[model samples]
Target: MVIPTFETTFAVPMTCEACIKDIEGSLKQLNGIQKISANLKEQLVSIEGTAAPSAIVDAIQSTGRDAILRGSGKSNSAAVCILESHAPHVENKVRGLARMVQVAPNLTIVDLSIRGLSPGTYHATVRETGDISEGPESAGAIWEAFKAKEGTACRGVFGTVEVSKGGVGTVFLDRPIQIWEMIGRSIVVARQEDGKFDKNDPDTLVGVIARSAGVWENDKTVCSCSGKTVWQERQDEVGRGML
Candidate 1:
């Protein structure tokens, strides 16, 4: 029998390695927790296993730390990344998250938030596919191309979020769009303040968040080859068998 697994990301406020150990200790008690990794810089926790999302979130919260479900590549899609400086001479300490909820078939609500950024107005937009092999940009590359026109990526611009002196802000877009439209795409937060996608200047880009999957797909699918699901069979057969 093959045991299936699921991956989920959580926004966790971890100040140090102790916090990560505490979270891991708490979650390790639960069955099906295959792996857990904490990204302190991004303040995010990534877990891969067969455990339930709620169970994992609850376990993390039990450690006396606040936790938010960034995205699970399931139900509602989510993407997360730490904002990086476009200018080599500058340093960025911002963290960004983008989540899409399917309220209706034709309409989706995009929720975005960023922390530890300079206090100011920022623009959010979706560019063309990016190259994710470049560290944080690896996932960010999902939506790196920006060809600003009237109704193209500009239309995907959710809006702006203002970071206060404390370096936190949020923006959202409640419009008509399908879940499939955003799956495997990327969301970008820019400090340019123009609300326009400028392909000419790379400095306009600030941070990026990449959604791993779409909500339209049933993330939890099973197969009946002696309890081996389709995904499991594919995994087993990959690079090891002749058809």
Candidate 2:
């Protein structure tokens, strides 16, 4: 019987056409790779093959680049999408992705990536309400909320991520919050246009917002060799609403 091929995608940091060639050349060294397609503009690579996911990722990283396994079509414990702003927003394109990884019963790591934003100071945070469907507009009230609270920081402020001239910034937040608490929440990216944030100036508000990622069905079934699998342990913790 012939083994069926599987598909996997990697979120790579590719700067140019040369980077695309490097990825193709490195991955070709692996056996059983049937097809490969790379999009430099999006920094995504798709591969259909029988190779183990690890081997494929290693190959890409071996070329002196970073790679994050987005998922195979079947399922994966993450969500990703390009960030969008309403009309009349800045011209720069923004891409945002959130991923959850459970490191311990009480600890979950939330990885965030934002690319193609203006090179300057920006704040990334989670909000009480705001769905991906409404985009950043859903978080417009966040500014007023900050003013009402008499604080410099907005509500649900996670942390600050710096975007360089290359237009890339990353944030890693480790919290006891469960995966369920994260999903369906809004992630807002606020730009400090005048080098300072003023509640009085609506222009100092956010431009991009997205819903955080969530876990998939198969993510809970991969555990082995234990009384309670990792996923089960996390689910138990989630029920308690923290850690």
Candidate 3:
């Protein structure tokens, strides 16, 4: 749910400043996040720019709070509308991130993207946005083997690089690399050619959203013998069994 100025509102339930801080912190720390304007009083947080609402919900949900996407820009739309949620847009930002693992080895790209997209909506946007991937380049590797072409990184002269998943290319025509934060299993996403998710199918988004939060279908089992889900103990047992 990214839009003009990358602002997507969230309908959340909180009790104190700590609550707000938690939400803000969780949302802002994502890979692509740039700025977050969270309001606990309104029980809402307008996540500005290039990120996804799924990340917001996952963040709050992980913290034991319910998070629902309201809407983007101005409209008489429902606060928890899924219309835009299913529009054709950038696929999961972390889909092929494992391939780009060497891009920022030190930063450890998490499934968080709210920090790099706080300026405007990704819909119809044609310009690069943030310097979210300031990892090795900042550290100065100074690789002279083949220094990139014109605009291939966060400091490129042209626009930033845009990741496309399940759609067309939506490269920002003015910047360098468009950074996205992939949270734990929670993935930060954007639109491909238009920053709009698959609007024709809501089910698609649902599946990925759940997967993004480490949720599997139909109470799947991580522990075949005990019929329990995988977490720490199960993982430890698996490791021990192999030993």
Candidate 4:
């Protein structure tokens, strides 16, 4: 099968040609990468490949530099969600993040990452409603539109991720769903009990999916709302364990 390829751009700290060479060299070792372009002036690296965005970020970080995904896919084809725990007394609620990009009409790539969770298998699914007033219970059931159209079980199931001993887990998945269908929905990640997810689990992380910028769609270096540069915002997100 031919894997679909899409372009993703990231903001990296590149000072000179050597920095670019180091990042390009590391990415070249990964499969599915067809092109790599680094701009020293813009501190941006654009990659065209079938590799997961998380993998690409890992590769760039391996070079001792942080990589911030600036944009992905075509115009209006990407979305993002920041998963947070609504459990009582949880000091730091942000637990995970999900990046979604529609690479094909029916294919959306979801790059999921989680930290500060117990070491075990967890299931992720898209809920029918974005409401989380009562946590996962209020998020409604797994999206049923795909089930009704395709005559299958709930299609909102995005499979599972195995959390490591260090409380970190990451998974890259592609589902036969469009990005538009997911906007304003809620994504929940929770530990399984008896091989099934329990919506009442207070520890289940939930977040509302919102549209994100596609390649070249966002170019501002400063945020108007926070009066912070892009790098500053990145630092804040990292400090909140959103990385």
Q: Alpha carbon lDDT of residue 199, candidate 1?
A: 31
Instruction: Write candidate 1's Cα lDDT for 74-147 as tens digits.
Output: 55444433344344443432255555544455555555656656688887765444433342243332232354
Higher-TM-score candidate of 3 and 4:
4
What is candidate 4's TM-score against the reference? Answer: 0.93
**Cα lDDT of all candidates, in order?**
0.57, 0.55, 0.35, 0.87
**Best by the lDDT measure:** 4
lDDT of 4: 0.87
lDDT of 2 at 207: 32
Which tens-of-lDDT digit does each residue in 1-243 have in candidate 3?
222233456566678889888777777666567677766666666665555445556676777776644454232211110111232453322111111110222221112122222233222211222212321111121122135565554321222233234332223222222223211111123333222334333222211111111111112324577755434443453343210
Task: Please give the distance, in angstroms, between residue 217's alpha carbon in candidate 2 and its true position after superposition.
Answer: 6.0
Candidate number with the higher TM-score (2 or 4): 4
lDDT of 4 by residue, 92-191 (tens): 8889999999999888989999989888999898989999887777887888744555556456888899999999999988888899999999998987
| Candidates, ranked, lDDT | 4, 1, 2, 3
Q: Give the per-residue lDDT digits (tens) of candidate 2, residues 1-243.
A: 233455667767789999999899999999979999987776678888666555676699799986656565343333333344433444433355554443344444455666655677776665556554444545434322444456454335556778889876676565554344444555566674122333322222333332332212333323465567444655553343211
Give the least accurate 10-residue stretch of model 2, judged by summed lDDT.
212-221
